[model samples]
Target: MHLPLDIDSVKGFLDPAEGRALHDAALAAAVRGPVLEIGAYCGKSAVYLGTACRTAGSVLYSVDHHRGSEENQPGWEYHDAELWDHAAGAMDTLPFLRATLRRAGLEETVIPIVGRSAAVARFWTTPLAMLFIDGGHTLEAALEDYRAWAPHVIRGGTLAIHDVFPDPADGGRPPFEVYTRALASDLFEEVLGVKSLRILKRL
Candidate 1:
């Protein structure tokens, strides 16, 4: 299937190789309803997943408050001045996310949810074909994200966690912890791994 936007044009940390792997996995797994993403950021991963969902006759719900996460704050290491809202004194990514969807002609295929993922999860009753969690990397935040959304994935659906680094020197361990917890819970089984991305199937 053809995608309207160039994948390289989007901004985010997802490596090209990993993004393609995610794209393929989402496409294969999304044989039904929407593939939900916990962190939309600037819509980089959204584009990848949205394209696949669209091709599969599914949808992509990109969820985020748009107010940058802790690590994205002005003083944080991953802060992007370009995303800062000076007047509001916060980082806002909603506009860029909207533009990305529009440019990609995915307005009909991708739905943007503006709010903290946990807050949205409170009211989210729909079953997901695939859930991609890349929101916060802190232990508390990562665990919250997992607790709020993991159960919503239907049995046999896919759950993907990004930025998992087993070695502390490589990166934070929150994501890896979530991955391990999922395995221990016996609710999910590892299905695939592409770089730092871990794909598991709800059992």
Candidate 2:
């Protein structure tokens, strides 16, 4: 069977270290049903998770508004600067992500959904085997994404988030604040990459 997602392009986007870590975790897990990836950006992370999904016989639902957050647009050197100009108007990132997934032969395994987390949550009732949240950076957005997705993660499933560290250049708030608050509730156990990146397993 053809592999889903382009390995080369994904490697080009993610840091070698972080990419390996995520790949390893995905490989180790027993992924079932559909995996959800919020905030696809340029489809870099999707390549990592999508590979695992293809191998494990699962689907990856990539969700993102793709309008480019103010923080993601400015100061973040990783993003395409031109996209922000378009995001400023009414452009969304779903199309670019779909194209990338198609190039990787992942169009079948990867489904791109355009909308906010709340709206998307309304349609999914099955428990997700993996949930990756790379949505907005603001406290409200981060919290909302977590609240909406956390319950959907099956017991022992993994929840991963990006932009967890404070970078004044990108934004004053780190997602840790939200993580810390959520962790206190005893719903998830921090598995790995807690400081900069966080991986939590449902308890």
Candidate 3:
């Protein structure tokens, strides 16, 4: 299926190749139930996954507080001043995300949950076909996101994590650690890796 959204126009880190892989993975998983994404930065990944799900008649629930993570804050290497909302005194991506989804005509297929992933997980009871984790980069936040949402994935579902660089020089190890831990737990089996994107099938 053709992606309805223009990935290049969105502000995010996902490579087009990884995004395409995510799209295929989400399409396969959506056969069982709706997909869930931990972060929705300007709807880049959302457009990829959401477009695929929409074609399959499924939905995507994007959970994010719209507050930039540690590395995305001012003075950080990944910080982007364009995302800052001076009036709100915070890093806000909600407006951009909404506009992106609307532009892609995916507003109806992708549902945005404006809150912390952990907080939303507490009340989440639906079984997910796919769970994409790309919210916080810190070890603490990454682990919390996994702990809260991984088990909620139904058996045979997909558990995808982003920014998994095995080499320390390339990037931080938190995401790689999460990938390894998820492997050691024996609850999931590694299936695919597109660049820093890692996909596992829930056991």
Best by TM-score: 3
RMSD versus native structure for model 1: 1.1
lDDT of 1 by residue, 111-181 (tens): 99999988999988999989999998889989999999999999899999999888889888999999999
Candidate 3 lDDT over residue span 1-203, tens digit each? 58775678899999998998999999999989999999898899999999989988999999999998888899999899999999988999999999999999998999999999889999889999999999898899999999999989999999999999999999888899999999999999999999999999999
Question: How far does residue 72 in candidate 1 sit from its true spot (Å)?
Answer: 1.3
Each model's backbone clash number: 0, 0, 0
Query: Could you report the Cα RMSD, in angstroms, for every candidate shown?
Result: 1.1, 3.5, 0.8
Identify the candidate with maximal lDDT. Answer: 3
Candidate order, lDDT descending: 3, 1, 2
RMSD of 3: 0.8
For model 3, the run of ten residues with the poorest summed lDDT: 1-10
List pairs with backbone clashes in candidate 3. none
By TM-score, the better pick of 1 and 3 is: 3
- Cα lDDT computed for each candidate against the true fold: 0.90, 0.71, 0.93
